[model samples]
Target: MSAPGPSESGSTTRRGAAFADIRRRQQATRGRGRRTRSLFGMMRPYRGRIAILLVALLVATAASLAPAPLAAKAVDDGLSKGNLDHLTVLVAVLLGVSLVGLVATVVRDRLVGWLGARLLSDLRERIFRHLLQMPVSYHERQRAGVLVSRMTNDVDALQTMISSSLVTLISSVLMLLGSIVILISLDLKLALITFTTIPVLLLGSLAFRLASVDAFARTRETIGAITAHLQETLSGVRVIRSYGREQGHLDRFHELGDENRRANMKTVYLNAAYFPAVEYLSTAAIVIVLLVGGAEAIDGAVTIGVLIGFVTALDNFFGPITELSNVYTTFQSGMAALEKIGALLDQESTLTDPAHPRELPDPLRGELRFEHVTFGYGVPSRGGSASAGGTGASSSPIVLHDIDLTIPAGATVALVGSTGAGKSTLVKLAARFIDPSEGRVLLDGVDLRDLRQRELRSRMGIVPQEGFLFSGTVAENIAFGRDGATREDVERVVASLGAGDVLDQLPQGLDTEVGERGGSLSAGQRQLVAFARALIAGAPANGDGRLGGPSILLLDEATANVDLRTERRIEEALELLLSDRTAIVIAHRLSTIRSADLIAVVEHGRICEAGTHEELLVRGGAYAKLHEDWQRGTTDAPSAAAS
Candidate 1:
């Protein structure tokens, strides 16, 4: 077997020989405890349907066994005696048995198909819900493409195995077992001859399964990696084109694809070598039966009818043996996929609500506070692995240290700092995207950890730095934050934010389609739409036609990506979204910081300066130095109209 990569390996492992031995034991124990049990647990919900399907399979097997014996009876009781009426009656009996078997086969297939579809639907829903509830830090550390592959490609492989191999294995085993018993009953000596070659087929099947387990596992891993690479490439296509790296990406993709091809080919070659060996053994068994049974029949030791029946029974037995080997390949692949999926399910979300969650008081005041907050990306101890729920180095380095800040009701607080200065991280904490490693974040005098996440988040509005939009109409995207929002509500928010000009530029206004991730809209248009979405979300109602969203707004670089003209439009929209709410803005542009009610200059996870923009400028602190740089840049560029 190929060695495990950094990612397929466990979260913790040891390197030295003694430690490696311990690690292996731990992994084996874990596998024995949960892997197989989880796989069977997935099937438990469909046990009733599976039971009915098995009954159909057994009936089909009994019908199939009847035809061989009836043929024997026809030759012995009618053909040999020259009784024309008996022959006709025996032939008619065979036809009835065949028809019954055909119907049973159809019923079995329908049951299998239905069960497979239901299991797949349930599995997909379970995985998606689990992933959605995982801490945001888990997603931040994972590749988008890898996660998508787990949801799509891995699940598809599992579905194929469940729908085909599982049914085939059960039916084939029943047919093989029933045929062997009938063969022994028909002619003892001929059955003994058939049993001699059965050992060879069983041994070959075992060998084939062992070899295929590793081959299919490798194939699954390679496909997941290739999918992840492709997803990353597609998402960054603009960067590749701008940097003239198209050929480089194509070459890398081809390399990964070639690896996948080789892995699959290995499985193909194993099957090629295995199935023919089974066919050879099966044919050899028939030849032995012919040689032994023919002599015995001619010597008056066995009847011709019994000889013919034994040969037919042998064929039925070995055919299933060969088919069973083929099913083994799929079984191995399904097990491999289950292992990966189980690992994902085993991951525990680091953040969860208290057992008895406390609710905020009726009518929240939109106040937020950070009490001695300190956060980092990793574990505190030496050699301890950090949770996948976090990103960056394994060794924890403090990002925010002893931060105690509070924003009163309906205040705007802007965070300003250089890149990597923890501005974004602080904003994320306010939204409880990631909790502080040390200290507590409270909303309206209550700890955030004590409140249910959905309840807390639903009462606040958050606009991310990227301004991502789903594939939908302009109106749909705007109303996404507030379920059941009316057309009038969307229009009022649009006009209130001065985003009507953006609608005029669109092809169909509110009905215009935004491509995937809002690709069809300009960066500025997406920002304005996101702003309007935030504004309309959680709006308070006065029983009239007016509804306003949550009283708190979190803006993370709201104007980071837009051009100057687009930035002005977003700034105008932002003014309305931020009005009458507690606003925390992560600033990238100088204009945003300049207009803040309070500005806190962040440096290496600590607030080095805090005051009004002018107060900091007059103090000549870190904020003053940053303002000086901004003024110098403005002097070097042409002035534009303000929002």
Candidate 2:
């Protein structure tokens, strides 16, 4: 296969960079809608719990208000009247009310915590479910690290608001309202004087909210940026070290961290300015009330008890105002989080299940067909390769255009091409990982688009060029191929593939940890394990003839990343697995090239040659040229390896 020119590689890099920038801007600049609606929408499912919580808050508020009035009664009706019995009774009532308020507070908090936890759980699950339904194209266009940040940091901010900040907000509003009502009843003149500062408080709050909203939005963006940078850098740490680019990566990380710091500083500055101003206004209100109420008490216009009660109400009022300043900050942060998370939830996936899907046949014949298929990334412009991670760099708009091909049931067909010939895209079509933009892929005479994805995919087995494994034991990774697969089933598949020898070499055999992405294993070992996983997922049934495994196999250069010995083992395993199944294999090696039952040579989004190996050789066309090149490379490999 010829290598891409400098222009093609440069274009790919530029396109990838441009695409990433566009995505980040979209995430950052999404419309800022009212968070209350989104928050309530999530809480709607727990309406019963919310109603109960509100009732508890109301009870608590009422109980808290009881003490101020009782103090007044103790002063005016008991102490002033020299009635010891009344004073004692009033004190007892105040104590009882306080205790009831405490109990109610505890109950309210518990309910709030429960509701918050449940909402977070539901939100996380909903995001994950939606993501699962999204098409491969959507994920390809996104950065996994950014998505992780959305799922973690962004969601966590909202969770914090729910679990802790919400209680403060509710308590402040309730206290503020209760304080105002009681102050009016105690002494209307004094209450009106105290309420004079209300406008200042309102204005300050509004200003803070407006200023802090954008600050917190930037904070969220910086957080995502830093997280994405860290994840990307660490995932490629080995590459950085090998290339001696650690300092360059460190500088980049420092830049991201610095941006995060600056964003946080903006919120800090806003809080510093807003909170102190609120406190000053609150204190000013208190002093004026103290001065005016003292004059009224001295002149005998108001009772000492009434003045004292009014002063207490004044404290309650200003206290909540100060508390609400803090709550406003938290709310702004939560709102920022909601905007980011809401954007993610609003993303529409291109791939969707048909309203009414046709059921596939019970015993699938596994025949595969592509009819006049065409596809592009998103725009008309196209350049993508069939190779893993290759975006075919084409000056034209089409990637795969009007290509036609078929693989008969129980036949082994190999696709051979240059790096960007759309072989992998063809394989993806067979797996229905993506839909063709202009044509149809059929399985057993039924259009793939008409079949349910889950049922259709369940009957097919695919192993991509890259073998990805999760963090788990070797046995667990293998068993992941099929749900509910047992240790015995794993062992049986291993034994059949003669993979027991590989397992025996591990320190803990089947229990050996694969680490993240099977990092604990060599490339060859990982491939072997992946192959075993595929085998077990599609293992043949018992003697009763009931189908247990997949009927179709799609292998995209399964041996591309392994050593010669490993490749031989994989080929041997493939021989047994492919004997009774329809198979489509993407070939890069000469050995794979010669062994295929039918070799299809793809060129520029079309099949330029198709025939048996011997027949193609006799024709002396593209296949013949590819065959000669393979032979020449095989001859030179030994010398190249020795040097």
Candidate 3:
């Protein structure tokens, strides 16, 4: 995009500043719309109801003003001329109009309230649906509390504007206009005096509104901060207790509470001054009207009933103005929330599915290849860091360089390395989580990037070092990879993985709740669940002619957490699962690595040794040293555990 010009940029900045002002004013008004445009936008969906309500409001206004005229007529044509018949008829007409106005007002309130609620529901659902569709990275950067606020408080603020503020604003303006017209008709000079305080009222309202806007915005920010603090503290409450830091956490929480309190007090202070100031101006207008109109009425320039009607109309007019002022706070808060939500919606995901995706053919033969693949974690280089200026140790470097490898279909390969070996990074590259900075990863001679990510991921199974589980039943966790899978399907998978006995031993069999993050399950059980999930996911579809399933199975330290006995059971299941599939196991145990068709010892970002177990042992280089270290560690583990 071309850079904006000074005038264009300046105008944009000015517009932003104006919006900021509006946001502040909106917070002050508390869902009251500063701009008619925003208010109308919210009301647009309920235009029909609003139209009906408007008509009713007009009827009510007309009916209400009608009584004043009848009252005046009752005095002039009945009591003044000693006509009791005229007086009774006029009194009864005034009473009938009052009843009609009351009914109309009630109906108008109901219609507006219903419309406001419906609009709020629709807006909230739209925002939530959009949020669900957003990519993972978008969620990673945003605060949970802020998102909740948008869905709740922000939507609620809009509701207030829709239900009451908007209608009152319109009706008030109409009432004020009608009153002005009636006052003018009665006597021009007196009418001018009544309206003289209007400019001052408007100025005071605008100033207070702007100040209140700032106050409300601060209040909202403080509230959001408090929410975030509380959420974080609760989430890590266990850690806090373990560290004996409860008092420290309480102090921090108190600080946040105090900040929130101060912000609220500031808003309350502004509101206190604002309403009274507006009321004082209204009082001044009333005084002016009475003083000027009293003299006119006494001189017979205006009648007593006309003067009385004008004061009543003026009182009615000021009610809407007061309501409008009250709504400013809610309006400010909603606008501020909108700006935040809008920013989230505008964020573009770095990773996106292609516009026209090419699907991978089924019965995918897992032939993998890496061609001169040089990659990095995309970590920014800082001065004097070992990875900087290519001055790092040969055993550790910034990037994986010129990696060339190929794994034939249905082969089992093991990758072995120490810490900082870039082993996990290599697997991530193979999974296509991150694209290579240079070269490419190929699956069955086709560049992995050419295939749809969804299709690619579905065809492969991954078991991470730490098996993460959601809050659900054991059976639900197992069946997660395959949506709409039946209980029979889950049972079969559990049986196939030899975890049937484990499931039967649970408190409620497969129906037992796993607790959040499978807290109720042991680490070994969690691993087994992940293993079963992977096995079930890799199994062939019912219609497929092929016996064994997934093209590739990527196991990243899959058996690390399990005991030797459990590992042996897992290995047995792995053999069955890997019978006709290519398997790349990031081996943490010598027993697992020894069984592989090929073993590659990765050091730094390159393969230092590659061979079968027997071949690597005979070679006695990096592989032999690693095997020796593993044997020694295994020997020492029993002693350490016993101690």
Question: Local error of candidate 3 at 605, Å?
Answer: 5.9
**How do these models rank on TM-score, best leading?**
1, 2, 3
What tens digits encode model 1's per-residue C-alpha lDDT throughout 1-643? 9988885565445345668877975884587359778767988877988888889989898897887778788888888889999999999988988998999999998998898888888888988999999878788888888778888888888888889998888888888999988988898778887888867877887788767767887888888899999999998999999999999999999999999999999999999999888888888888988998899899999888888777777778887887788788888788778767777788777767779999988788989999998888764311232422554365767889889998988889999999999998888888887778778788999988789988888888888888889999999998988878888888888887788977778999988999999999888788888887887787544466555777788988877876777677667656665767898988767787577788999999999989998899999989888888887777777654242
Return the number of clashes found in candidate 3: 19
In the range 46-65, model 3's lDDT, one tens digit per residue, is: 77887888889998878866
- Higher-ranked by TM-score: 1 or 2: 1
> Which scores better on TM-score, 1 or 3?
1
lDDT of 3: 0.75
User: What root-mean-square deviation over C-alphas does model 2 reach?
Assistant: 7.6
Q: What TM-score number comes out for model 2?
A: 0.89
Per-model lDDT? 0.83, 0.81, 0.75
Report how far residue 265 has shifted in candidate 1, in Å.
Answer: 1.4
Worst lDDT run of 10 residues, candidate 1, spans: 379-388
Give the per-residue lDDT of model 2 (tens digit) for 377-459.
Answer: 55321122222122434443566888888889898899998999989988888887777767779999998878888878777
By lDDT rank, best first, the candidates go: 1, 2, 3
* Top candidate (TM-score): 1
